[model samples]
Target: MDLLSLDFLILAGVMLAAGAATGVLAGVFGVGGGALMVPVLFEVFGLLGVADQVRMQLAVGTSLAIIIPTSVRSYLGHRARGAVDMTLLRNWAVPIVLGVVLGAGIARFAPPSVFMGVFVFVAGVNAIKLISGTRRWDIASDLPGGLLLRAYGGVIGLLSSLIGIGGGQVANIIMTLHGRAIHQAVATSAGIGVLISIPGTFGYILAGLGQPGLPVDALGYVSLMGVMLFVPTTVLTANLGVRLAHALSRRSLEMAFGVFLAIVSVRFLYAMFAG
Candidate 1:
């Protein structure tokens, strides 16, 4: 395809717009923007003539690659406001990395449906709880001790890696359900994104190595071109999201996050059952 073609320009514009939205979502919801980027990349990759066999993997890998910078920027913004939980991040770090490694291994062999199933189940449950706006949804007054919390972190990392997320959605849901404030949960989630995205990106590159059907400009499953198109806009807009998140009321933030999760769940559900 010609670089100056109308189709190329349209796709470029779409990527920039998606990057902007992704940055906002990362800030407001404390996610790595994968929930939005994965779907967008899938469609964009398809339109660009990527084979069906590798399209989903390419989307996921590219999303993770893009999340690295965006998550870092968002995390720093949250940290500046003193919203981040350093102790929690430290405690969860090892288990999360281990989980990401396991998930990356699984990705090398798993089918696309496996990821869709995980995404739907996780996002759907959290969406229902937060959207209902009931105190009864609170599972405990505080997070579980030691091994249990570590296990949760592992699971969060595993799922996030498979689905190409920042692990924020999983962390935020757990934190909020255990009585943590929405702002704190959101801030902490940004840190989780940082942990997940770095290893996740490399894992994907390793996973996709030597795989057939990968497109041009791909290093394994990651599309370097896609990363180039997304990074600048995503990084520039992430701080804006942080400011908006801090400005919102606790209840308002929860509602917003819940709605975002609901949309993610629905999108995957449709793909699994209808597409």
Candidate 2:
């Protein structure tokens, strides 16, 4: 395909527009926006004729790369509001990174169905909780510390890496269920995105290194083209999401996110059973 052809230009425009939406989602939801980006990137890669074997990995890896900057931008925005829990982040850092490494290694051989399963299970459960107005049901009076907390971090990182996310959905639900305020949960989730995406990106890169059927200019599974098209727009629009997040009531935000998770869950469920 001609790099400057009309068809390619149209897809490029689509990517830019998607990036803008992604940035807003990242900021508002304290996510890395991979839940949105993975499916979009999958379609784009398919249209671009990436091989079936490698296209999913490419999408996953590229989404992680894109999240690095978007997560940072979103994290900074949330941190400025004095809502972030630095202590939790500090505790989770090593475990999360280690889990990311393990997950990325698994990604090298896992099928798309594996990822979809993880997404459907987690997102579906969270969707039900948030949409049913049970988001505040306390699993504990407060978050656990020591080994248990680190285990949660590891799980979050592992799942996020597998599914190309920034770990927000898992972290947010965990925090909220432990009696943390929704605002603090969301803010802390943004920081988790930062921790997940950086090592996750490198892990995917290393995992896909020397793999076959990769697209041109792909750094391992990470698509440079997708990253290039996505980063600028996502970075520009992140602040808009942050502002919107702070303006909404906690209940409103929870409901919105719940709806979003519901949609994501249904989409993947269909893909899993019907596809």
lDDT of 1 by residue, 76-182 (tens): 99999999999999999999999998988898677667778876786687788777878787889989889999998999889899888899888988898898998
lDDT of 2 at 17: 97
Per-residue error at 210 for model 2, in Å?
1.5
What is the TM-score (0 to 1) of candidate 1?
Answer: 0.96
* Top lDDT model: 1
Compose the digit string of candidate 2's lDDT tens values, residues 210-268.
98988878999899999999999999999899999999998899898889888878877
Error of 2 at 48 (Å): 0.8
Model 1 worst lDDT window (10 residues): 107-116
Give all TM-scores, in the order shown: 0.96, 0.95
Q: What is the lDDT of residue 15 in candidate 2?
A: 97
Candidate 1: count of backbone clashes, pairs at least 3 residues apart or interchain: 0
Best model number under TM-score: 1
Which ranges in model 1 have alpha carbons more than 4 Å from their true place? 1-4
